[model samples]
Every structure is written in structure tokens, then in C-alpha cells.
Target chain A: MYRVALRMLLGDKTKCLGLVFGVAFSTLLVCQQMSIFFGLLGRASSVVNDVREADIWVMDPSVKTIDVPYPLRALELPRVRGVEGVAWAVPFFKATVQVRTHQGMLENAIILGIDDASLVGVPDAFVVGSIDDLAEPDAIAVNPAGFRLLFPGEELDVGRELELNDSRAKIVAIVDAAPAFAANLTIYTRYSLATQYTNNGRNQLSFILAKSADGTPPEVVAERIAARTGLKSVTSQQLRRESIMYVLANTGIPVSFGTVVILGAIIGVAIVGLTFNQFVMENIKQYAALKAIGVRNVKLLFMTLGQAAFVGVIGYGIGLGIAALFFSTVPKKSDALRGFYLLPEVAVGVAILAAVIVILSTLISMRRVLTVDPATVFRG
Target chain B: MTTATDTLAVRCTGIHKSFGEGEARVHVLRGTDFDARTGEMTFLVGPSGCGKTTLISVLGAILSCDDGEVDVLGHDLRALSSGKLADFRLANLGFIFQQFNLLPALSATENASIPLVARGESVKAAETSAREMLESLGMGDQVHKMPAQLSGGQQQRVAIARALVHSPRILICDEPTASLDAATGNTVMGLLRDAALAGDRSVIIVTHDNRIFDFADRIHHMADGVITHIESPDSSREDAP
Candidate 1:
């Protein structure tokens, strides 16, 4: 009977394809939009994620997100280091500065200043030169994406010269860093050199990156520092979440992406419901004949559900495949789309949503089949 | 212990059925009495809206009569719940429709195998039996052809095969030949009579086509929701009210 039901669905190629297209279109829209949404959230905290060695981040009390940071006084570093369970604390400087490329092109670049003595906040991976080379005179490391932006047609190599805030700076390495939300070039240099370049007021500390003494959880140490120093202190994970939450609270991204997701679901239900109802209506006489010939309503229900399941699976598979192909290829070719890919959790969520769409449509159509008078078969 | 009437395939008495309510109510079947014997073909013949179809629907257990003692193959149909009635139909009854009602997606063999499949037989085994039945009806080469590919007579033959596939105890047909030409109609009636009248099986046909009247052992004439009279091919007509 299930086989017969599937044959009935597949018999009308046009209608079957229409149903598949409806589900597939819904899936593609939901998955692609959700991937981009999550990817954007990830980029919001990309700076914090890149500095893997820091377990706790100490910032000014007013700071809410990494992108919009309020610099702390330089003395906040020693204060955080004096707190209990603090092994060491390093001064980290972050400020956006204007850069003049060797080609005389002016662009905005974010400068991350790590400790001059330890270089503890630099990204661990490098594409061109070694991390030790940051010790060179006026040395800095540029992320690969930033390097491409600064050099355009040039291959990745160190020893490029650029002007930062009217001061000469030399790129000693090409670092691998997560793409930033602002889509700006990222430059890493020593804290002292960065302070010299930026020349902000004496309060130049962006954040204090701290490591908890062994066996002490970062969350506990973070609470201690905040209580003692009257500053905002949070674990690295907490900061990442805060960063994403700040974007959600302050930006229009959620409303924009949320509207598309809702529209996708509505369109899916409408398409599947109407198309399935029409398919059932067109074959109503045959269903009545089956009913008259002794098919129980339960059996008819199974047949309809089986048809819905078939279309749901095929449509979801095709849609997910297309979404995966987009994530796999598009991000590689486009710089702005970097770090965006389909998440497994998002895929699973979309699948459950697709099932709901199919089942809801099938139930609506089944009402007609279940109530059809078998006596109608006798009338004609 | 069974008497002659006890062995009858279907028996109905004072069957009352109506549609609508209040002033719009219309009585479709009123005090209708009908019976068919085993191993014989019974025809219910009447003009349109004369209650022939309603009487057969009651006998087939596809519709409930407002008031009646309805029995088929020794089981009282009015005593059965809807689920049990469906079970009884699946186990003991078969139906043929005017439209053939062959699923256009399935081949002739698959269409003919529905009864057996509905009765819990494996599809493979059901199709094997259906293939033999279709072949016996001289449709061996067209077993795999879809319904649209077959002629009207051939489609009716497949319908007949479907009706008899599970070897049902009672076979009910509604205008089985209404869509066919005279020659094709006669040919289909011949196949139904030959293939369905074996083995204590009762075949009841509700049709308006007089050309196939000679194929029935008994013809029950209905008018205004009641059986007016009964006629036998071997004897003169008998009047019953």
C-alpha cells in the first residue's frame, strides 16, 4: 500500500516536483539566512576567540562589546594582576587607525597591541614569517585577508612598509586571524609601538588579558577582579556571548534575518498545503473507490503520511545539498562572505521544521480523504 | 442446520434510509427488501433515482440504513461497527465501479491485486494471483500496461479480475458496463458471469443496461425506494410488494 501510495505521488511528475520545489525553496532560504546570521554573530567576537591564551578579559566598566570598547587606565593592568588567583595579566590595546598603503591608498585598519615583553595576545598561527619576528624594529603582523587588501595583486610576503597614523610601520609576518565583523584589516604590534603610533591620552589600555592561577576557574577569578577593581570582568566565553548579545540588542540584524526565516516558513506551509490538497482533490474518486473496496481509514492515513514523508525527505536533501554547496564555494571566492558556512545544528533544526511543514500539509489534506463517502463510488 | 434461505448471500428487510433533514429531507430508500442466493447472479435494475443504487449500497455495507435487518453471508451487518464492517468487507466482499477506478499510476496487474493486498496478502503474492486471473481473461500481454493504455473492455476485464482476486464470497458491481459499447458491455458481462459465479459466490450487479439482463439468474426491479417485483430467466415474473 505504501508502494502504491508513492507510485500515485510520483505518477504526477509536475505536481510532485512542485511539492519538492516548495520544500526545497523553504529549506534553502531558512538555512542560508541562518548560517549568515550565526556567522555574523561569530565575527562579532572574532577578536576574543583569536587570543586563545587569555581565559579572562578585564575591561572598563562601561564596555559592553569588543567592537565598541572603552579604554581602561594603564594602572588597571597592575590592579588586575594584584587580585587573587591571577598568574599574570598583560595590557592589550585595540584601536582603529588610518593606514596609508605603499600604493598611497588610505584605509581604516584595526590595530591589536599585545604585551611587548611576552607577546601573549598574538594569534598562534602564521602564514608567512614566524611569531618571534615581531621582535624586529617597528614590526607588526597583518592578517592574511588584511595583507591581500593592502597589497591587492601581490603574493603574501613580509617586509612590506605602511604608514599608520603618520608613523612608519613594517609588516614582519602574515598572521591567520578570524574575519572581523567590521570587515577591516587587522594589524598586530607591540603595545609600546601601538601606543606610540596611536598617541591617545594616557588612558590607552583597551583590555587586560589575564590567566587564572592553576586549578582556579576563570569565572571565579573574573568575579574577584570585578569586585576589587570596580571594572567589568568576564570569562572569555562570557565575553563572546556578551558580544553576540550586544549585536542582537542594538542592531537590526535580528529583525531582518528573522523576517526572512518567518516568510520562508509561511511560504512553505502555504505551498505544501495547497498543492497537496489539490493533488488529493484530483484523485478523490480513486480514494473513494479504495474506501468502498474495503480500505480502512487508518490504512488510508498511513498512505497519505507515507507520501508526505517521501516528499519531505527528497526536498530537504536537495535543499540542504544546495545550501552546503553555497557555503562550500561562495565563502572561498568572496572576501566579505569569509567565515560563513552552514552549521550542523542549523541543518538539523531546518530538517525538523521541514518535517512539520510536510506533516501539517498532509494532515490538512487527509481530512478530505478520511471523510470521503465510499458510497460515492457507487453513484458513478 | 442451515435452510435454503439461511444460505443466501445477502438478506435485507424493511431497510429505511433518507438524506437531508427537516423540510429538505428526501427519502432515498424506504422499506426496501432484497436477497441474493449463493452461486447465482442477481441484477438490480431500475430507472435513475429509483433507489437501486441505494439498495445495493446498504447490501454492500457501504451505507447504513435508518431501519433494517441487513445480513450478508450469515453476518448481520447492522450489528457490526464501522471498523468491523470494513473488516468484513475486506474479508468477504468485493466491488466493481462504473469508472473502473483503476489507479492510473499502477499497471493492470497491480490494480487487480488491490483486494488481496487490502486483505493483508503480500504484494508479490497478490500480483502473482492477479496476473493469473488477468491472463485467464485473455489479458496476459497487457498485465503491465496502465489503465489508460487499455481499451474499455480490457479495463473492465481488469476490474472483474480485481473483484474476484481474493475469491470473495459476494461481489457487488455498480454500472460495471455503463461506459462500454454494446458488444464490449456484453463481453464484460460474460466475463463477470463466468469468472464470478463459481464456488458458492454471489454476484450482484446494479445496472440500467438491459442488454445484459439475460445473464442474470434473477432480476429484482426497484421503484421509489422499494423492490417492486422479482423476475427469473427460466420462469414468468413474480410480484412482490
Candidate 2:
């Protein structure tokens, strides 16, 4: 029975290849596009994740998204410290400004300045150099990934310098592979440098980064700060949503990605459906003959579904693999493509759509299956 | 219930079937009675679309008659549920279609092994039995050749081998000789004759080829879904047990 089923599925090379390719194309598009999109989103909130490092974050008033203005880091820092469950409170600086580099005037860099003493907001991985390098005045940390982009495949020494703001900053550290998602070109500087860079105009930080002591819910600390400081506080998980909510609502990203997703799903279903329908139509006689031989209906259905799954899984995997390879090798300067980076949850969501399309497209032809009077084979 | 006729391979009476509903409804079979006992070869011959295949499907348990009594291998077809009817067919019936219907991707031996494997036999044992059946039909050397690799005559022989592999009590063929040349058709018909008559089982071939009529122990001609005439080699074809 398996032999027959195998024959039924791959009997014709043309049809089998068509099915595989249809699935492959769909997989590639969905994976590659989504990877870059999510990669960008991760970058958009890099400063928040870096500075807070906390289980929770509190914002000013009813702030939503990391871009929202918070009360001066000086004023809220003490109020958060006064909270019952509070273990630690620190100031974080986030702003975007143009930076002068060898490549060009790179604009809208998410500038972050962690307090001079703490250094809590630095990139986690450093491909080259160590943290002690950031200790020097007029010194800053640069991502090796960015350095490589400005000077491809070449290493820059610590003494090398780039001018940002009016201050002449020397690169004391070259951090390798620090891929901060969005801030792939990030340069780490002291809080004072950030103050001078932005001219101390606002005189306030983005928000506060806090850590709760043992066995304390971040919600408790957040509520304490909200009641005492009255500067609306939120947990890190809530901050993550707050960080993304504005960009999602204000920007046209949802509409754009939503359109692309719909197109991807439609094309996926159409290609697979049309191609697989051809496969089944060509094999109709074999199915009829199998029915004549007393092969049960359910078994035949299983074989079809199994073939579909084979196409879906293999094509999806191969497509994503190819897409990922393409994305990884892409120069950072290229239009930000993360290439279908998704967690298990995202993969499941994508599959639900594909599976429904497959079943829907195939179900239309099942009528022919059920109607296949075994007598047709007897006559023909 | 204990009559000696209980040993019969097939017994049917008053089979009725229809298609569609209300104004579109058409009766295909009405009060049709038929039989093909053990060790006999019965041919149900009719011209195009006269319900020979439909009747065969009903007898093969692939189709259920609307109202009838059908007893095959001591199991009442009308009484069994749809699933059990399929099980009965799997256990006892072997079918060959007119088109030499072998799965294209599979080798001839694999095609012949389908019934046994469908009945849940292991692949190893199934192919072993398939090889034996194919060898009996002179397809032993071509066991591993896909359907495309074999000539039409060889493919038909493989089909015949498949129908007989499970040692079914009833072997049913619809136009088994349709695609073959006269010589090849005769060879296939001879294999059927030997398998049914010599082995004490029954073979029913539904074909209009009068040349193969003598190969059957009994030939039944049908027109408009009713059996018009039935002639047997000997009246004692279904002798009392």
C-alpha cells in the first residue's frame, strides 16, 4: 500500500516538482521578508532593552512606546528608589542624532548614554577589545560590524577616530559582532558626552532602568513608583509593548506588512492549489483503479495529506534556509532585510494559513475523488 | 440456514440501485439476481455503460446496492456496515480493471503486492507472495520493473498476478483483455481459466469479447442492466456440497 501511495504521489516528476516548488517559493518570501521586518523591530527598541535590563520599566505620565518622554531621570530616580520592592534605580539616556563617520553622515542613530559608573547599557557581546577601554575620556566604543561596513573586511585600531558632534572622540574599543539589530552602527559614549551631544537641552532621560530584589514582582515596584512619583510606571514586558505600540499604530508598517502577508498567503495557496490540482488530475485514473482494488477511502486521503505535508515542510524548510543564508550575508548597508527571522510562535501562525489554503484548494477536487465510480476504470 | 448451498462463493437476489433524486432520478438496476459459485468462471458481458461495472462494483463491495441480498464468502454484504464490507472485500475479493491499472511509480511486483499490503501484511512477505504470483504468470524476471518498463501484455499479466496474489475466493476482472492483442488476451484469459477452474475458486470477467466466452465456465449476457441470458459449461457448475 505504501508503494502504491508513493507511486501516486511521485508518479510524475513534473507534478511532484511543481508541488515542491510552489511550497518553496511561498516559504522563501514569507521567511525572508518577516526575518528582516522583525530584525528591524528589534533594533527599534534596542535602547529600551539595553538600559532597563530590568524585569520592569516605569514611564512618565501615560507613555506608550519607548519614544514617549519621561520625567527627568534625576527626579524619578529617587522616587523609584523610595519604592518598597525597589532594589536599584539608574538613569538611561536615549536620543537620535546624526553622526559623522568615514562612510557618510549616518543619520537617526539611536544614541544611548548609560551612567558613567554603571555601564549597564553596553552591548552584550564584544568581538574585539574589552569594557575597560570605555573608561577613558574623549573615548568611545564602536561596533566592528559598522567599522567593517565603512572599510570592508579591514580592522580598525583603537587609536582610529571619527568625529561626531563637535567633540573629537577616539575609538578606544572595536567591539566585534555586537549586532544590536537596529544599532548595528552604534557607538557607546558616556552620559556627559550624550549631554554635550544633545547640548543638555532637555535635561531629562528616556526613562529609568530598575531591578527588583529577591522574590519581588516588578508590578509591585511599578505601582509604588506610580503612586509616589505619579509618573506612570510599567513592567519590562509592558514596556516592550509600549515600545512597539507607537510605531505600529502611527507608522504605515502594519498596512504594508499586512498587504505583503496577504499577498504571500494568496500566492502560496494559489500556486500550490493549481499545481497540486494538476498533479491529482493526472493521477485520477490511478485513484480510480485503487478504489477498484478495494483500497479504502481514508487511506487514500491520508496519502494525499501526507504528500501535501511533505511538500509543505520540505519546501518551507529549504526556502527559509536559503532565505536565511541570503539575509546573513547581506551587507548591513543594504535595505534592512532580516530574512524571515521568527520564533516558534511565528512559524505556527504562518503555517496555519498555508494549511488552510492547502485543505481548501484540495477539498474542491475531493468531490471528484468521492464521485470516482470505480466502474470508470472497469470501462476504460 | 444450514443448507449445503451455504458453501457458495457468491449469492445475490433482487438487487436494486438508483442514482440522483426526484425528477433527476434514474434506476440503473431493478430486481437483478446473479450468482457465481466456487470453481466457476462467470462472464458478465454487456456493451458500453450498461451497468456491468456497476454490478461488479456492488459485488466487489466497493459499491453497496440499495436493496438486495448478497452473500459472499458466508458474509451477508447487506448486513455488514460499510467498513466491514470493505474489510470483507480486502480479505476475500481480488479485482482487476480493464486498464491494467498499476501504480506508475511502483515496480510490477510492488503493484501486485498491493492487496496483501492493504490487508496489513508486512512489505517483505507481501512482495514475496507478489513475486510468487508474478512468477506464476511469467513476470518473475520483470518484478522490479516499473509499469512503464513493461509491455501492455506484461502489465496485464502483472494485474492478473495482483488479483490472484491474496488467494481470494472470488477473482473479478472487468475487460481484462481489452487492451491486449488477441494472442496476449488469450494468454491472459488462459491464466484466468486455469486459476479459477483448476484451483476450485471463481473468476468473473466482464467483457464483450466473444472469443473469450468459451474460456468462461459460464457466460452471462446483459442488456439495459438486466441479465438476458446465462450459459454454463455444465449445469452442475455449482454442485451441492
Candidate 3:
């Protein structure tokens, strides 16, 4: 009888495909949008990810996210390093500045000042020149994608020059880094050069990136630093989550993406509900025949639900494959979407939503089958 | 009134049923009494809307009467709970329809195996038994062929195979050969008659086909929701002049 259910569902190719297409469409819409939304949230914390060597970050108490960092006193850097369990600490500077392209087009660029000695806060890899080239006079590293954003359709070069704060700055290498949530072009420079380029007043340190000693948790060291210095300190992971939470609470991203996800669910219900109802109606006689053959109502109900589940799984598999392919392919064409990916949790969430859709629609379709009078089989 | 007896495969008394409501209400069956003896093929012959179909449905326990006593094979249907009644039907009764209502998506053997499947038999075992039954009915080479690939006669034979696969003591057939040609209809009735006389089993068929009445052990005539006459084929031929 289970085999019977499958054959009945597959018997009508056109209606079967219609059901599959409806489910796949909704799954694609929901899953793909969720992936992009999570991708944006990941970008919100790219700064935290870029400073991977640091296990904790110390900042002014008022700073809520990397995007809105308030500078701490330069003396606080050593104070953080002076805390017990602190392995090493380094001063990092972040500030938004305007840059003038060779074409005279001005755009906002985010300048990240890594420590002069260890280069602790720069990107992980360089696509062109090595990281040592940043030691040259007025030299900075630009992300390949950020470079494209600043000079679209231009080849990557080792010595492209841009004017920042009315001072000459040369891009000596292309770094591979994720774009920030704000989509600002990124420039990596030495801390002392960044101070001269940005013209900051005294106490120019925006954050102090720190590492915990071996065998000590970063959260423990962060707590000690916060208790001693009267400044905000958090583990790298906590800071990343805080950044994401800040955007979630302050921006309209949740409402916007949430509305689309709900719409996807509604579309799934409408398509599966109507077509499955119609399919049951068309197969009413067969159901009556089964009932007359002494098949219990519960058995009939299971058969209907089994058909819906098959459609749901097949549709979800196809939708997830398409979403993964979309994430892989679409970002290559646009510089702004370089590091998007589908998360495992988002896939599980979309699968749950699809199951809800199938179960809800199956209940609606089974109502008629449940109340069916087996005597109807005699009418003809 | 017919008392419960081991010789009777089905017995019903004062069966009542109606359809629709208010001004559209229809009294489809009015105190109809029916029975089919074991080891006999009983035919119900009636005009349209005469309630023969409703009477057989009550006997098969597919539909309950408004008020009646329905005893099939020794179990009082009204005394059994609904679930028990369904189980009783699965264990004791087989049904065939006029249109050869085989599921088109299933192969001939799969369609024949439905009764056994509903009876909780494993599918592999059920299809194996169904294949043996079909082979006995001269459908050996057609086991895996779908319904559309078979002739009308072969489809009806597969339906008969399904009805007999579970070895039920009683079979209810509604217009079993109504969709077949004259020769095919004769062939199907022959199969039903053989099934009835094989081992003290009973076959009750509600049909209007007169060409096959010679195959019945007894015939009941109905009109306007009540049985009007009963006839044996010998007496039917004696009164033919």
C-alpha cells in the first residue's frame, strides 16, 4: 500500500511536477534569502574575524561594535597587557576616511591600522605583493574586492595611488579579506602611518587586541582586564556576537528578511494545499475503493501524508542544491558579495519550515478522504 | 426473519437506509431482508434505484443500516465495534466492483494483492500469493502487466483474483460483469460460480445482466426498495413459457 501511494502520486506527471515545483520554489526563496541574511550577519563581524590572532578585545566602554568603536587611552593598551593571564597585546586603530580615486571620484574607505611590529590585525593572505611591502613609505594593502570596488574593471596593480586626507597613499599589495557589512573599501596600513594619515589627536587607539596565555580561557582574561581598567573587554567570539546583535536590534534587517521568509511559507501552503486537494478529489474513487476493501481510515491518512513527505523531501533537496549553487556562483560576478555562504543551521531551519508546509497541506487534503463513505464505491 | 445458521454465509433482517435530507430525503432501502447460503451463488436482480446495491453494502459491512440485524459468517455486525467490524471484513469478506476498479498505477499482481496487504500480510508474501491466484485464473503471463495493458476480460479476472486472494468465506460483487462484452461476462460469471461451489463459500452478486443468470443457484428480484420475488433457475425456466 505504501508503494501504491507512491505510484498514485507519480501517476499524474503534470500534477506531480506542479506540486514539486511549488515546494521547490518556496524552499529556494526561503533558503536562499536566509543564506544571504546570515551572510550579511557574518559580514557584520568581519573585523572580528580579520583580527584572528587576538583572543580578546579591549575598547572604550561606550563602543558597541567594530563599526562604531570609540578610541581608548593609549595607556590602556599596556594596562590590558599588564593583566594576569595576558599573553600579548597590541594597539589597533580603525577609522572611516574619504579617499580620492585617480578619476577624482571620492568614496568612503575604512582604514585598519595594524601593529607596526607583528602586523597582528592585517588580513591573512596577500594576492599580489607580500605583507612586508606595507613597510615601504606611504604603502598600504587593499583587498582585491575592495580594489575592484574602488577601480571597477581595472587590473590589479602593485602601485596604485589614492589620496587620503589630502596625503599620498600607495596600494602596495592586494589582500584577500571579506567585505564589511557597510560595503566600505578597506585599506590596511601601519599604526604610525595611519596616525599621520588620519590626523588624530592624542589617545588615538581605537581598540587593543589581546591574546590569552596558553591554558587560560580568553573570557577569564577579558573579565580581569575589564575589572582592573574600568573599560569594556570581551572575548573575540562575544564581540562578534555583540556586533551581530547590535545590527539586529538597531537595523530593519530582521523585519525585512523575516517578511520574505513568511511570504515563502505562505506561497508553499497555497500551492501545495490547492493542488493536493485537487489531486485527492480526482482520486476520490480510488480512495473509496480502498475503503471498501477494508482499509482503515488511519491507513488512508498515512498514505496521503507519505505522498506529501516524498514531495517535500525531493523539493527541499533540489532547493538546497540550487541555493548552494547560487551562493557559489552569484558572488563571483559582483564585488560586494564576495564571501556569502549557506549555513547548516539555516538549511535545517528551511527544512523544518518545508515539513510544516507539507504536514499542514496534507491535513487539508486528508479531510475529505477521512470522511469518505465507502458506500460510494457502490454507486457506479 | 432468518435466524443465524452455520449454513448461511450472510443474513440481514429489517435493514433500513436513507439518503439526502429535508425535502430531498430519499428512503433508499425500506425494511429489506436478504441472505446468501453457503456453497451457493446468489444473484440480486433489480432495476435502477431499487436498493439492491444498498442491501449488499450492508451485508458486506461497508455501510451500516439505519436499523437492522446484519450477521455475516456468524458475527453480528451491529454488535461489533466499528474497528472490529472493519477487521471482520478484512478477515472474512471480499468485494468486486462493476467497473473493474483496479488501481491503474499498480500492476495486475499488485492490484490483486491489495486485500492481503490490507489484512497485514507482507507485500512480498502477498504478491506471491496473488500471483498464484492469478495463475490459477489463467492470468499467469499477465502478473506484472498494468491494468491498461490488459483486455477488459483479463482486468475482471484480476479483480476476481483480488477478491479470492485472502480466502474469504463470502464475496460481494457489484455488477461484476456490467462493463464486459457478452462472452466475457459469461466467462467472469463462470469464475464467480466456480469460486462459490469450491468449498462451502458464498458469492452474492448484484447485477442486471440476464445472459449469465443461468450461473446462479438462486436469484432475488427487487423493486422500489423491497424484494418482490425469489427464483431458482429450474423454476425460472419452468415458468419461462
Candidate 4:
């Protein structure tokens, strides 16, 4: 009986292929868009957690996310280090300054400050003259991804400086692949280097990034830290989702994806329904013939639904394969596009989508197939 | 009145059928009484619009007579529910349409085995029986042919083989030879009569082709929704001349 339905579909390969590709195309469009959208949300908070590799983030109690507060001082670091589960605590600094690029001065270059000793916030990409230059007072490091945007052209060995708030700073080591907080155009300097130009003193600093003691739950330590100090403490994961939601909610990503998923489901209904309807309609004569010779309506129904489900299966398998191949071709720098997790999430999502497609369309076309008049077998 | 000559395959009395009512009523079969018996081939002969096909359909349990006691195999159709009637049709009767209706997607063996397989026979057993039946009917070489691949006579042969696959108590054929030439029609009629008479299973063939009158063990001539004549081997009109 399954073979019977398959034969019917294969009888018109062109039409069946048209429908399969139609659904596959729709699935690819919707799933890739979702991956990129979630990837975008990931980008907005990548530096706040991923770069620092922090287990917990301690910020002002009033803050919902890491971006809410300015850089904090070395004084709070001591208070946090004394906490039971705290292994090491690092104070990150955020300072906006006028960057004098060879192209033009850009205003929103987010300054990331970490002292040279632990360099807890600095990633391996730090290169060029080196972190030792941070001891040179006015030197700052910039990630290579944003290096060209910050320094547009090659000028002679001359003094080019960026002024933060009031004071000036010089370029130091260049890092590679390191993430930035606000936008891609970022400059990193030592805490002492940034402090020279700091107008707000030790009071205005970014959240404290912390690594917990072994066996201590980051959530439990975060709760303790928030309770001990007047600041709120969130695990890096919590802050990651919160910071992402902070940005995504503004961009309405949730609403957009909700719409796409719903539209995806409806498109599934339309594609499978119309396709199955046409399939059964074209093969109705065969069904009448089957029925007249004593084939049960239930058997005919199974054959019809079996064909629809087979299409769903084939289409989903093809679509996911295409999506994986597409994702693989992307270069490593495409962090935004590199985040498709085909494990539990996509497996469940595609399963739900395919099942819904099969079940809905089978039921829609079932009414027609079941009511077929067996007497029509005599007509032709 | 039915006789002890054979168990009544079908008996319809006061059968009335109307498509609509009042001024729009198209009475297809009105007050038609008919009978088909086992151990004989009953030819239902009538002109177009004479309701012979409708009467045959009623006999086959495909369509119910509106106001008649249609008894098949001693079970009164009006006394049974629709579902029971359908089950009776599936279990005890077989039908061959004028079109030689066979699922084009199915092979000749599968097509012939539909009734037996559908009634819960194992596929392997049904296929074997169907193959043996087709082989006996001289369609052994075309067992794998689809309906579209077979000639009209071949297709009709496959239909007859299917009708007898389960050894049905009665076989009702509607114009089984309508689409065949004289020779092919004679061949098909011979196969149908032999199938009916060989097993003592009743057979009713509804057709207007007078050329196959020799195949009939009994003939009920119909006109204007009425049985106008009953012909038997001894009293057949062909013997009068």
C-alpha cells in the first residue's frame, strides 16, 4: 500500500518534485533566517561573556544587564575577592573617546581596559608592539578586526593620538579576532592607561568578571555576591541572555521569528495540502478502482497520507542537508552565521515542522479521498 | 415466487427507484420484479434507459432498491443496515464493470487479488490464487501487465479472474463485453459462462448485445422498468424459429 502511494507520486515526478522543492525552499529560507537572527543576538553579547570567559558578572544592583553601568574601580575588586566562592575577579573598564583615524574621527570607539598583570580580559590575539607597551602610559591595544576601521591608513612614524573625555592616548599592541562590546570599532588599553584619561575616576567602571571556585555553582555565588554588595550579580550565561534580550527586544526579533515560524507552519499547510490535494485528485480514478475491487477506504487513505508523509520526510532531509552545506561554506569570521546548532533544537524544530506538515495535509486531503465514489470505476 | 431449482442469488419485488420527487421525479426503476438463480447464467437484456443496469446494480447490492425485498443468498437487503449490506457485498458477491475497472498502478495479479486480499487473505496466498486463476484463464503470460497494458479482452479476462478469485457466491457483470469485438466478446462470454456454470455459482450479465444470447442459461428481457419476458433453454425465443 505504501508502494502504491509512492507509485502514484512517482507517476508524475515533475509535479511531485515541484512540491518538494517548494517546501524545501521555504524551510531553508525560514531556518537560515532564524539562525542568523539568533546569531545576531549572540553577537550583541559575545564580548561581555565569551571574550572574558567569565563565570559570573557583578554589576550595580539597579542594572538588568552588563551594559547598564560604567567601568568600576580596583577597590570593588578586593571586596569581591574576599567572597567565599570567588577564585579571581577582574574589573573591566568601558570608556568612549574620540578616535582620530586616518579617515576621520569616529566618536563611539568603546574603550576596553584591563591591566597587564593578569590580562584577564585580553584574548590571545593581542599582537604588535605587545602588552608591555601598556606600561608606556598612553598606549592602547585594538583588535585587528576593528584595526582598519579605527586607523584608516598607514601614516609615517608620527604621533597620532585619541582623546578620551579630556586626555590623550597612543596606539599599542593589536589583537586579532577579539570581540568588542558596543560596536565593532573597539580599542583596548591597560587599566592604568585608561585611568590617566578617566574623568569619572574609580567609581565609573564596567561590571566585574569573575571565575568561581571549583564546585561552586555560578548561580549560587552570584546570589551571594548580589546579597553581600549593593550590586547585582549574574552568571555570565544569565547576563548573556539578558544583554541579548535587551538588544533583541528593541529590534523585535522575537516578534519577527514568531511570525516566521507561524508563517512557516502555514506555508507547510498550504504546500502539503495543495500538493496532496492535487495528488489525490489526479489519482482518484485509481482509488475508485481500488475501492470497487473491495479495497477499504482506510487503505486508500493510508496510501494517500503515506505519500504526503514521504514527501515531508524527503523534503525535510534535503532541506536540512542543503542548510548544513550552506552553513559550512561560510568563512570562520562569520560568527553571526556560524552558530547553527543542529542538535536538540533544530532536530526538534524540523521534526515538529515536518510532522505538522504531514499530519495537516494528510487530514485535509483525507476527506476527499475517503468520500470517493467506488461506482466511478465503471464510468471509464 | 422463487423455486427450489436453485438457491436464489437475487430476488427483487416491487423495486421502486426515483432520483427526485414530484415534478422533478425521474423514476429509474419502478415496480420492477426480477430474479437470478445459481447454476445458470442470467442475461439481463434491455435497451438504453430501460433500467436493466439499475436492476443489475440492485441485484449486486451496489445500489439498494428503494422499496423492494432484495434477497441475496437468502439474506434480505432491506432487513440489513447499510454497513451489513456492504459487508455482505464484500464477502459474498463480486462485480465486473463494463470498463474492466482495474487499478492501473497494480499489476494483473494484484488487480485480480484485490477482493481476496481485501477480505483479509494473506497477500502471498491471494497472489498465488490470483495467479492460478489468471493462468487458467490463459492470461498467465500477462500476470505482470497493468490494466492499460492489456487488451480489452485481456482486461475482461482479468476481471473475471478477479471475480472468481474468492469463489464468490454470485458474480454480476455490467456490459463485460461491450467494448470488445465479436470474437473477443464471444471469448469473454464463454469465460464468464464457464466460470459461473463450472462452480455452480450464479452469474448475471447485464448487456444489450443480442449476439451472445447463446451464452445465457436464462434471459430476463426488460423494458420501461419492467421484465417483459423470461427465456430459458427450452423456451428460448431463438428456438421458436
**Chain A only: TM-score of every candidate?**
0.97, 0.85, 0.96, 0.83
lDDT leaderboard ranking = 1, 3, 4, 2
> Mind giving the per-residue lDDT tens digits that candidate 2 earns over A18-59?
777777777767765666567656655655665535766767
TM-score of each: 0.97, 0.86, 0.91, 0.82
lDDT tens readout by residue for model 3, A217-240: 999999999999999999999999
In candidate 3 chain A, what residue range of length 10 has the lowest lDDT sum?
Answer: A332-341
Query: What is the descending TM-score order?
Result: 1, 3, 2, 4
DockQ of each: 0.78, 0.52, 0.63, 0.33
Chain B TM-score of candidate 4 stands at 0.93
- State how far residue B102 of model 1 sits from its true place (Å): 0.5
lDDT per residue for candidate 4 within B9-103, as digits (tens), equals 78888888776778998898888888878877888888888988677767766667778678788888778765566677778888888887666
| Model 3 bad stretches (over 4 Å) | A73-87, A103-106, A153-157, A200-203, A213-217, B1-6, B19-27, B122-125, B135-142, B236-241
Off by over 4 Å in 2: A52-59, A68-90, A101-106, A116-120, A124-137, A145-154, A160-167, A175-184, A200-218, A235-237, A323-367, B1-8, B21-25, B232-241
Scored against the true structure, residue B76 in model 2 reaches a CA lDDT of 84
Candidate 4 TM-score versus the reference: 0.82
Candidate 3: deviation at residue B52, Å? Answer: 2.0
> Which lDDT tens digits does candidate 1 get at residues A248-362?
9999999999999999999999998899999999999989888888899999999999999999999999999999999999997766778899999999999999999999999
**Evaluation by lDDT, superior candidate among 1 and 3:** 1
- N/CA/C clash count, model 2: 9
Candidate 2 clashing pairs? A31-A340, A35-A340, A35-A341, A36-A338, A36-A339, A43-A182, A56-A236, A65-A242, A127-A176
What's the TM for chain B in candidate 1?
0.95
Docking class of 3: medium
For each candidate, the alpha-carbon lDDT, in order, equals 0.90, 0.73, 0.87, 0.73
Q: Which candidate is the best by TM-score?
A: 1
TM-score of the second chain in each model? 0.95, 0.91, 0.93, 0.93
